[model samples]
Target: MQLPATQAQLSPVAGDASNRRYFRLQLPLRTVIVVDAPPATEKNREFLAVDALLAQSGVRVPEVLAADQERGYLLLEDLGDALLLSRLNGINVDHYYGQALAILRQLAAADTAAVALPEYAAQLLAEELARFPQWFLQRLLGLDLDAGEQAMLAGLDAALIGSALAQPRVLVHRDFHSRNLMCLANDSLAVIDFQDAVLGPVTYDPVSLLRDCYIRWPRARVEQWALGHRDSLHAAGLLPAVDDSTFLHWFDWMGLQRHLKVLGTFARLSLRDGKTAYLADLPLVLEHILEVLQVYAGQDVQLDAFHDWFRQRLQPAIADQSWSGR
Candidate 1:
């Protein structure tokens, strides 16, 4: 309840893709993080609400030590600066991803009735998808969708919506990627940036992790992790014994929808919010979309048209960036 003892120092930590600022409080016995969420522009109260929800769900999130709602400040247990993204490499990815998946399994069994969060309904998903055209395509890239491309997008939207609604619904950390996951001292992962949690497709979180924006994995390896997670879900009775092919469809389309949203979000961050750093991450997200699109391109004509449009239009924009390859 009290502030850190005298002589404590505060050092800024790298901020996430948010308006909030975090600083590490260095004290004699321990370190804690302080969140400064200027009341006028940010939603610290919603963050507190979601924190309780995730903690009650058994995920290891930060413990709120002190908070000032009117001042928009909170003292939180420092989960350290070790991000899962920094820890992952060829030698240790499997080990870390295994732990990450274990946390997700725990989340699968959490009590959804206890906390109130919005459902990732079809309309919500469609609205998110619309950002791709409105923000990324028109605003950022200065491109327009032809009538044929628009029709193709309509069909692709129907496919994405159908696949998402068909999957088992569960509590989703919406941004359950490497960056938001912290590496605790005990070696367990702690989740953060979860104010956007939702009741959505079971494949959504898994796809977010494996098809991360800030990082990438081989297609074969990602498929292995994804299908392996599907097996665990089915074995736990969270999902029926859906065939691999069907589950793959759900996973692929879910990642596509998510990446489309991410692309628009990154563009909006740069153009509207004046956060130009996210523009650098756009290439990787585009690569993720292209990877999944190629897999599903042949089966549907409308999808094929959209995929061709992406390859022709979006691919060239990033074809030369240094971090372009996924």
Candidate 2:
């Protein structure tokens, strides 16, 4: 804190898909992360509040060394560059994921009402689902849908939103994926980019992590990990005694809602935001969507119809895209 400005070295760091920018400030004795998150557009106040809440709940997060809320600047303890994504492999995924899941448990115990966290209610869920139609289907894929197709999509959106609202609510790290998790020098995992935390379905964060957009795992293994987490949540008195099928229905449907939103989000990032690198991730996201649609086909009439529409109409278009990897 006492270091002279002239002696400190500031270097730019790669940022996520947001208006916020990050820099590394290398001082004589230590280094810190300097964030330039514009207050008008960024959730600086929410970030500070959630950081305190997570720390108090015993979850690892970057310590706020200093903050200027009006100016939208923060000095955070550097948690190092070892993102959890870089360390995941077949040999150590179970171990690292176990630690990551424990963090989710800690988040589940946090007092959502104390922080007045926004609920992941139906309106917000519906708004997110709408992005798929606006950005992904129309803007990105250049798909033109007739009135019946639009009605079909609307029905599918309602189903997903209903599924999300039916689950037990908990504190959700809205982007609880590998990239947002840091592996500290001590080998403990820390959370980052948690400004969007909300009170949402219990399965939201779990599905965000287990069925990450940037990575994929086999269905059987993913279900095992998901059910194991459900067991832990039940034992902790956070989740009521529900059968495996019901829990998985909650999980898979929650993931469907998320991946659909992600499809639209990624497309928006590419077309509107000019962050085209996100397009490369679309194939995997689509894969996740199709996998769920297939699993639930014939069980839900609307989902089955949507699946048929997607394969018949959208798949051919998607196959022709440069990023489709078909």
Candidate 3:
């Protein structure tokens, strides 16, 4: 923090799906990240507070060297840009994901009570589910639903919200996907963009990683990883004695809720924020949603109705989109 201001060089860096802008500050001996997260729209205070919470719990978040919450600027330790997404492969995925899952264990043990984090409650879950219909179906895809279709969607929402509420609550890194994970030079993984952390479903972060919106692993492998995590959670005393089928049901349904929210989120990012690049990722998210729907088909009347409606009504419209590749 004692370096000459004029001597240091600053350059733009790629940012995440937020209003924040980031820059790299090159000093004589080291580099740091300079973040411009406008306070009006960004959760600067929460970021700072959560950073302290995670750090105290031994989670590797970027060190905050300096901060000005009112002005919305932060100087942070530069965790280099080796995103976990870029490092994944068929051979190395098991090893890398094992490391990531270990971190999730630490996260599960973190003191959510101390931080006063918001609960991922039924209202929040339902609101997120609503985004799919509002932004994706109506706004982006221009699908005008009839009353019956609306009822089907409502039923699906109730089912998803109920499933989420049924899970054990833990410290959730809401966006625990590969891109937010930095594979440091020492081969350890570091978490970022955790300002949205909450006391949420135990399966939420696991599903976020296993069935990532940006990448797809085979169903068998994903299920294996998910169930393995469930065992780890049980060992850590974070989960009760739940069977594989029940745990997988939790994981799959959690993933469905997340993917549906992402569909609308990506659409809103494109239409409202002009970040059209997110549109390219929609097909993978849609695929995740469909796979879950197939898995749970005929098990629940409402879900079955929603699944049928999605394929019969929505698929035709989605197929026409340039990003759909259908």
Candidate lDDT scores, in order, read 0.86, 0.93, 0.92
Error of 1 at 58 (Å): 2.9
Local accuracy of candidate 3 as per-residue lDDT tens digits, 1-326: 65677887999999999999999999888999999999999999899989999999898999999999999999999999899999999999999999999999999988766787898998899889889999999999998888988888888888888888998888998999999999999999999999999999999999999999888999999999998999998988988999998888889889999999999899999999999999999998989988988988789898889888887889999989999987
Q: Put down candidate 1 lDDT per residue, 87-111, tens digits, no spaces.
A: 8998889998998888888778777
Residue pairs whose backbone atoms clash in candidate 1: none
Better of 1 and 2 by lDDT: 2
The residue pairs in collision within model 2 are none
The model with the greatest lDDT is 2
Q: How big is the positional error of residue 6 in model 1, measured in Å on the Cα after superposition?
A: 6.5
Of 1 and 3, the candidate ranking higher by lDDT:
3
